[model samples]
Target: MERARKPTALATTPGLPPQPQVTLTDSNARLTATLPTGESIDILLHGATILSWKDAAGRENFWLSDAAKLDGSGAARGGIPIVFPVFGTSDGHGAEKLPQHGFARNSRWEFLGKSTSEAAKEGVKLDFGLSSQNLSDDVRAQWPYTFGLLYSVTLDRGSLNTTLVVTNDGDVPFEFQTLLHNYFRVDDIEKVTVKGFEDAPYVDKADQFKTKTQAGAVTFAGETDSVYTPAQGPGHPLVIEEDGKPRFRIVRDNLEDAVVFNPWVDKARSMGDFEPKDGWKKMLCVEPGSVSKWQTLEKGDAFEAAQTIYLV
Candidate 1:
């Protein structure tokens, strides 16, 4: 009797539409979403941190430090790092034991799944999840609280949107802060100017966190670290311009504060992970989040915020 022939695999079966171009690479540590127009984004599971975002012209939109550690040893120095639980150092409330910026930026998150939308604009959304049960022993012991985080990253034709939902799964209330630390790539720092915080009061972190009102559009002349809050009113969309040309437009929802930071010369060199020594001159950070004050989440409650960056 003749043996049965083996089946052959075809690249495209019949006449069905081709599947979306999304993949998980780098040993499943990274997820990439690509559009038909050649725009794409790369997200690392280490922090759900967006490592790269390229436009149709293959130009990078975010700056990743040359010396950034990609081995999951520590937080990456660049890209969009998610800050949660606490921002910078723990202020108080039995959270002094927690590490600066909490564990969100260093913890490994679960790749929840992916979805697609074709409403007003075609887009792909990748979801990541992290919870109390997934934390390391050390992180759990620091500020014990049952919480769950669902982070969604959406990429469209000319924009990227990131939304974070924090849920309290414990019986008691907990206080926390969250921010999307964005390191925007620029041709030169001297030509970059941030618009929208003209009259908003900001706390200058470089000068002992003293409160000061912005005189006009923010410009970097030296080391700058300021947290602009909604003192006057809720924030509007902010535009990042280079030599009077808009580069990126940032729109925030439910995120009440914005942070502008540049380590400059001494601080840049002081950071062991910031490579090239002068990388500061090529990058500017205009971050949006709910960080000026802590948000209280009661048991079974949830809070959500989002930020969208449009390429101009």
Candidate 2:
């Protein structure tokens, strides 16, 4: 995979804080980042999944299910899971009929090391690599496309940044989907209001693939699953408002679609992996993705998608 610049010196970031120290520990199974402030981020190498991200005040911006399995058997039930090559079960669109959300989140990834950027000095970055060359025979046979993935997780002053860089190393072009299945923290599913998607067109996955236009800000009252497009508001972040105040702000770049979902009651109870029947009340998935359009990459071509999150 194409490598980023070597870790650079901390550049002057007027609004950002001091740079953090990044380390790989837990027997090379996890990477922990400690910022100058009291905040920290933990990334598990298993799936290149973010296990935890705490703000300066030690408040968590992510929600990991209480019943989540952390034994490295598969992807954890929470935090932010990267869905690539495909977002979900095939409903058409030539998506690889592989596992739900694909193997990126289920298979282990190589720790490709970390780097720093002069543009963002207060931030510390960790990188993980995955490729068809490292996949199990079963997975390779299912979707025989040679690809390289470089996933980066960063924590700076007061923001969390996750970036995915995909490279097509195969001879023929391949079609795929990519997304950040972000499970954000919430006090009440009923009181939390989401913005940036108003007036956007979406595919109501909960309603038989029905296409509809968003009438207003989104709220969770029942089962909610919709794929929104052009989610980039004119100049605004996707804000999560609670008790009439903003709490989480998310921004995505190089990604066209955004999916917001909450299984609510019945659906939440149906998944064995998700513990606590009422866990739906504590989390909301506002996924930034390239789902509405199938991204086709030719030989040696690459694509990158990134999301930055701030706790307000």
Candidate 3:
């Protein structure tokens, strides 16, 4: 038998230590999981940005944009990212437009490690932290409230749960608006309808911003925008029906307002990247946002709001 050639160091050690089992970086927030079909979900919280969300089928069609980059750029409410600290334009109760959705969403955040229970059986939870001690020019120029924001994102059993924990770090109290601007993917907007808030109170985006009744099950007839107040509680699931069959369910807790929007005509056409006509027909936004008035969070106190998205 020919003597085997002396094994070279390179040949003996194949492929860099198996590439280190797990990848821990700012983009992934150090969470862990292996999907049933052998895929993964990565959560990036720097500036509260969702860096990447790849499904089991190796599909990552979800929107991923830098929240920080959109500051003062007027692209605030167009994606799946969540922003807090006086959502929308506050009419006069400390609603500062310059900071639109506060600095937490756009400011860099520090990883807080595996949530005391970050990883769950059905999903993995990752936590990030931000406090006044970490504020910079951009944050200070805004609300000027000394606070801490803890963001928890969990991916499990065919859905994602995002929770926001706001803590008061200052000596005084403050009031603000919040929102989890959910950007759900769908086959087509025309082929779907949002069912949940029917007959519930809603303020139309048009007609001088007055409250009105839905009159019937929600459907995309045209450019639709409305602010809902005194929203129905638990069990009143916000169902997104695709072709009359439930496709996805959005459930929110402790959120008093639910804003629904689909920019079909004017607003969609104004954006260069958005194919006005096709865009609206492709996506419908159901904002589980807190607005129309300010909610209070006192010193040394904390408040939380969360929402879960599930496949149907």
Better model by TM-score, 1 or 3? 1
**lDDT by residue for model 1 (1-312), tens:** 765996777677577443347899989988898877788998889998999999989999999999987878999878899999888887595578888888999999999988884432457888899999999889899989999999999888889999999999999899999999999999999999988898888999999989899988899999999999844443378999999999999999899998999999999989999988999999999999888889999999999999989999
lDDT score, candidate 2: 0.84
lDDT of 1: 0.89
lDDT of 3 by residue, 1-312 (tens): 766896556545455321112246634533344454444555444465553455667765354323323332333334456667777665555556445666656655677754322444444566778887787766575667788888877766567777888898899798877887765556777788888887788889766777798766688777878887634673367888989899778888777778887777787766565643455666677778667667788889998888877767
Return the candidate ranking by TM-score, descending.
Answer: 1, 2, 3
The prediction achieving the highest TM-score against the true structure is 1
User: In lDDT terms, which candidate is top?
Assistant: 1
Q: Which residue runs does candidate 3 get wrong by more than 4 Å?
A: 1-39, 42-44, 51-54, 58-79, 115-122, 272-277
TM-score for all predictions?
0.93, 0.89, 0.79
Count steric clashes of candidate 3.
2
lDDT of 3: 0.66
On lDDT, who's better, 1 or 2? 1
Residue 305 Cα positional deviation in candidate 1, in Å, after optimal superposition:
0.3
Q: What is each predicted model's overall lDDT from 0 to 1?
A: 0.89, 0.84, 0.66
